[model samples]
Target: MLNEMRALTVSELTHQIKQQLEGTFFHCVVEGEISNIAFPASGHVYFSLKDSGASLRVVAWRTQAGKFRELLRQGEKVEIRGSITLYAPRGEYQLVANQVSPQGVGALYAAFEKLKNQLRLEGLFEPFHKKTIPAHPRKIGIITSQSAAALQDVLKTLRLHRPDIETVLYPSLVQGADAPASIVNALNIANTRAEVDVILLVRGGGSIEDLWAFNDEAVARAIFASTIPIISGIGHETDTTIADYVADLRAETPTMAAKLSAVSQDELRQALDLFEMRMTGVVREKVTKYRRYLHRLSLRLQAQQPAHFLKESRQTLGYLSEKLEHLMLKRLSCYQQQLTNYEARLNPRHLVGQQAMLLQQLSGLESRMADAVKRKQTQEEQRFEALVGRLNNLNPLAVLSRGYSAVKSGDQLISSVALVNQGDELTIVLSDGEVIARAETIIPHENSPHNKGI
Candidate 1:
């Protein structure tokens, strides 16, 4: 009976343990001081994360090890986010960390906390100092790195939600020592213009040091001093910064900040309803104010009529075009979101084909809309030119321009040479001037009536 039982080889036992460990500790975050940190010529990192009594082996592949290699000092505290796997050959369980962040990093953290507390004590975070955001802002100014994905995210959200709103970008450095000054300058410029109703200070999520620029004292003060309401969307939802507290509004992410700056379709519809009810009362109460406004508007309107007409017309078309395009893109993004959730389960080929087809459809639609706009503009120009042609045809000066003249004999138009006798007084009207002449001779044809002279 003992012979009937099978014995597990060393390889089999190791594989079974590896499966168990990987299944349970597939992903986790651990914090400890690094020790015996070794970076060999192969570029992989070998280290041990240990506290008082326990030590865990850690391995970082070349791709991720480079980012934190300089900070890999022995006994340095850090937080590692990775999965655990067993190296079957050595039968050792080690952490495979892809992200390593300094934990309560000695100087940077202390400095950050110090500044944050100082700002709070100064009442920079007070709610009373905050400016109210406009309900339906016509213009939104954005401050961030031009290359950041946060800018793209906010722009996409803005386009999707409010295609009619005008956007102005104030690109600046969102990292390093100079970032604070750059951000402050951008804020000052946006406020100086006093053109935009709101400003969004935003950037993507990053490590603490990478995001330290947003936590700067100068940036926080700039946000507090802004005349325009500022919405801070710096980093992920869990990340906290001093600028977020000093700003008028704090968004969980850059996308949410963009959402806050935009007026949704539902809000627009509700606003329209409320506007109608408020208009009558508002007009009655503000008659004098409106009269003065109208006087100023009349003067400006007279000067800007043609330009205003064209600008308004183009804005209407642009808004419509943007709305249509973004709505379609939003739907595609939804499909992409769904695909992302099932990307592992679905065939890659199928996903690629689906994306290609959608892109083709979108391109066709965009091309057609562009062509339509072009054709409409062309048709209007042609119609205007046709009207001008008809007007020219009815103009008497046009015939005169084409080498024609009129002869008047004694205040009566002379139609035939016979009517103009020799030495008759005649007034010849040319395009430029008039000539008064006494016909010296009259040449008449035999077939002409009364032997009319030519």
Candidate 2:
């Protein structure tokens, strides 16, 4: 009795009932007169399917009131085939029509559905089967009627944005009986040649009968099987066909198809700037390493004799300095050339401004580099001067200032009597002057005044 008395919330009961009714009428075919019809901007049709006995809510999604926009009318007798599903939010049951037709005219629509369902079951329309559309295609292959206005639209768009990219046209019938075969052949030829990076399957807007070729099984299969990614631009934004689903990408119009194939000039400029920044970063890293090496060498100088080490290190530092200067100049020149080349390719709109900015930046960089080199040179010079001052203090000339002298015979220093002969001419170097003298009599060490008792 307690089990029976247990209460269910309104939401829980509604959900249970929704599941039961939805499952019970999963697939249904209803023949009724249309009433309470509302066509919303989202392209989903809302209407009630009514007969004398009952009226059921029905929606034909994305049909846009069929190809000619006159398929459904108030009180018009029609058949809708779909699955029953709960709207959930309103807790109302409705029919989600996958196929809708006005009595006898359904034969063609039925065939479209048949092919769509079969291909869908085979997973051709799955995201996994779709190829990635190239972000920037170097060459785009166009497949359309030679006389098509859509072809002109595509060409004009590509020319406006990316005139550098080449295009190859494979003229094929876009309509009528021979179009399917022509399209298939074009696709096959494109695959065989593989000249283009991507293919644009395009046509002008038309009625369902006029656009029937794109729905052909052979065309759909060809599009799905192509090695090159295919972008379908068939009919207007509201129109949907089998090829649109099978394509790697779908554009609403022929112009949009071309626009999608290549990026804009602004994007290219940004890429160039990014490349320049990365290159600048590399140069900065090299400069930092060289500076650190110089710093390490400077620290090592204090512990070792500067005379010999400075001579050898000075050569190395000079070479490295010249090498660094040459490398920087070359890199800057390369950047200038690259900017000039890219500028030529880009649209002239605000191009002068960009070039000016880059030039300013380049000038700033050169100035900074010069400053860095100048500072480094000044630091090294200061360090060298201080080292020379220390060396001078240790020099014998400092001792000669306090009543001492150095005597030399020719280029040799006469340090002892054994180094000089009698009457040898000598040049004595004092602190501030030199004197010419002669060793008139060479005395033994024992006979010198310091060696004998005073």
Candidate 3:
């Protein structure tokens, strides 16, 4: 058989072997831990899958790599499904992965998926559990590595925003096996002291391994349990960790965390200056408006003054006095003319008869005049009594003396139960004193049996 295939070109022999391998392993699934991962600029992932003295070279193109990016990691166990292929240029045989997933997760990414579903069902990521950050925090606590450049960035941003805010640093390891515990301890310390208004857990950006501590369940639980609001600034804007989901706030960076926690002093100063200027302008406008109103009122009052009224009254009185004097003189002249006329008509010897007739007429006139005077006096007395009764009815002092109260709500009278509700504040006016009370209950007039007066 070897002689029958002799003298064949190297390419032909390799092709035959490639064809045999492809037919033998048309479609297969392999499980192993990832090692020697290399992502080249050619947009292909090259890695070796090894487990106990055996390794297979594998290649996943950019298309397949995208789907498995979240689930694949160095040293992580995985299962890959693909077909065997040969590269003619390099004359090498390799497995081309079509689909990749975490090992044994064909049953469903059971462990990862189970934890995600459980946490979601527990409402750990609900919006209602989110706490609002203080608009202006008096103090900020930082949980980070003391030697990290992240600390310096946070401090600088804070100083730029609000210099008066007190910063308390709780030093902790941000990486390595102890990082999760260190972070938890720092959070506990911050809570116990209660000196900080808000806590910020921050770290600089790094590779997935460098940021792995933030994904620890212990750290996530600690962040959730903290009573004080926490802002997490763990990595770059693109990075997300389990701690980021549980934290009250997520900031893009350490500088952003500081900026969010405090208000900018320059901005505040500018705002205050703007407010002061507005108030000054409003007050000045109001004063000018009121002054103009007062000036007009003063002019009107001057025109209506009592002195001007009194002077007009004096001129009217002088005119009435002159007319009264002229009328009196005319009446006296008419009386003298009447007397002369009567003397001409009377006889010199019949003076007694005329005197008797005059006395009778005089007596009749006196009787009529006396009756008119008595009627006038009776009407005047009745009018005076009616006036006195009306004055007594309108008197506020009289009502107060009778121990009656006049309650007022604002400037309005309080007369009905429908006007107020429970917990409404009221001003109660009694005859002797005033009391402020919040209404605890309102016994409706229709519902109260005592109000029936039985």
Residue 227 in candidate 3, Cα distance off native in Å: 2.1
By lDDT, the candidates rank as: 1, 2, 3
Q: Which stretches of candidate 1 lie over 4 Å from their true place?
A: 1-54, 57-100, 270-454
- Per-residue lDDT tens digits for candidate 3, residues 183-300, read 9999999999999999989999875567878877788778888999999998877767777888899998888988888668987898899999999999999999999999999999
CA lDDT of every candidate: 0.90, 0.87, 0.85
Quantify how close model 1 is to the true structure by its C-alpha RMSD in Å. 47.7
Model with the higher TM-score, candidate 1 or 3: 3
As for lDDT, the candidate ahead, 1 or 3, is 1
**lDDT of candidate model 2 versus the reference:** 0.87
lDDT tens per residue, model 1, 248-267: 99999999999998678668
> Could you tell me how far off, in angstroms, the CA of residue 423 lies in candidate 2 after the best superposition?
99
The residue pairs found clashing in candidate 1 are: 443-453
